[model samples]
Target: MSNIMETSDNEILFIVKSTPGNRQREPTESDPVVSTLHNRKVYKGDTTILAAEFSAKSSVIIEWKKNDFTIYKESPQYHAGQSILIINNVQHCHHKKKYSVSVTDSKGRRVSSSSKMKVRRDSGSKISSSSSSDSDE
Candidate 1:
């Protein structure tokens, strides 16, 4: 059998296979850029909506915060959505508060932006109250 295998008339076949190890690539995302501009202005007893937008290569989760605290969705006072945040009634309590939106990818990449709300008195008077967490504006 060995001599027959070695001879040209009889042949034996052997097959081998190899594969390179796969390398995992790190997740990447661009800095979250807020598309919503123009500070919203709403008088007392009026509803106002704030919207923000951004793009990323991977799936991302979005959130809205007021003064660094997470806002609940569809709450009586605050209505939060994937891209839009709504304040039911503009009131003194919300004036000049820092409102921010953050986008976080599944890989833990995160970016955020913030702005202050300007709540005005419904009465036609120049006297309006303003407050802020910091004196940035």
Candidate 2:
């Protein structure tokens, strides 16, 4: 932290407003200091659906807000051309939002993607899956 010399009342107030990094104002005599803000990964905009091939079907759990939307919860059976898309309906989630998708391996670990997508409106487009055998010449 750096010390500030009292310039003017307005300038000093502006400096207080522009503090860098995480912030939690000192508590008043009766109240405890509180900083409830968290930095969470966010996606913006309508997402796209793409074609993919899955060896087996598993439940897809989405954690947004206080709700979790699921697919094939009781029965994890996803077939070819299955859709996976995110609609931008959540607050602060901009259009064509970016999400960090975690695909797990059989070992129960996650695999992250290094790329992001700029997609179309959720309901306007659909994502499907496709599979084929690998080929080598």
Candidate 3:
């Protein structure tokens, strides 16, 4: 017995084949598996994106969180799954912040991945001072 699963060009394909005397169960909805989430560094006032990728047998729900608090999609910072989490005009307050992405499959199985954001102050923003004094000639 052989089975082929149809998938979109952007989706991964899985093929299963079984021989006589060897029975293989058909695929079913499974938990989403996190594929990637990497730490990112960006300069203050710049934009940064935290992307998350997953693999599952069925559709899944994606959610983003910061410091364990859910980040609503209505917020301008959220750009949905395509970008996962987009931070515009990053600030020092966001430095060392932890961001996570959770994916839940139809079966209720869920998985998560997290990454930290490192914000660096722009060199041009640094303040420098110089003083010069001359004695009476």
Candidate 4:
């Protein structure tokens, strides 16, 4: 018996000999499996938190990206993300933006999950109410 698996641009093949009372063994270092990032909705200027849970046999590196662009850890808006990513002061520019998180294990196997941000205007804000009135004039 044989089976093939794909991970991070690499393929792995497994071959098993059929025998009486023989059982398949578990893999020692399986690729990291990550959780989905659910889409979020927040008022402008609010804080947002995005998290991706993963399981791996070895330590892993976590990275975050926005709209396919890398979001550096040094960015003011970016907080820690061993598994959780925080973005503070969400603005209009963040509306509809796609955010992704990648997890890479020691073996260089990587997987990613993404979610979109929906930023909404704060209806209670005076500035938003005044802007709507002005636009109608």
Which candidate has the top score in lDDT? 4
lDDT per prediction? 0.45, 0.23, 0.48, 0.51
The better candidate by TM-score, 1 or 2, is 1
In model 1, the runs with Cα more than 4 Å from the true position are 1-33, 36-38, 73-82, 123-137
- In the range 1-137, model 4's lDDT, one tens digit per residue, is 21112111112111111111111222246566666777666667655556555555555566667788765321111111235555555676644588787767678888888887767777323222111222222
Ranking by TM-score: 4, 3, 1, 2
Model 1 weakest lDDT span, ten residues long:
1-10
Candidate 4 local lDDT, residue 7 = 18
Q: After superposition, how far is residue 12 of candidate 1 from its true place, in Å?
A: 81
The Cα RMSD in angstroms, rounded to one decimal, for candidate 1 relative to the true structure is: 26.7
Error of 3 at 58 (Å): 2.4
Candidate 3 or 4, higher TM-score? 4
Mind giving the per-residue lDDT tens digits that candidate 2 earns over 5-43? Answer: 222221211111111222124323232221211212222
lDDT of 2: 0.23
After superposition, the stretches of candidate 2 with alpha carbons farther than 4 Å from their true spots are 1-47, 50-53, 56-75, 78-83, 86-93, 114-137
Cα lDDT tens digits, model 3, 1-137, are 32222221113121211111211222245545654566665667755555554455555566566778665321112112232455555667744577777767667787888777666777322211111011011
lDDT of 1 by residue, 1-137 (tens): 00011111012111111112221233245443334434445566654555554555455566566677665321111112125555554566654577777766556677777777666666423222222121134
TM-scores of the candidates are 0.55, 0.26, 0.57, 0.58
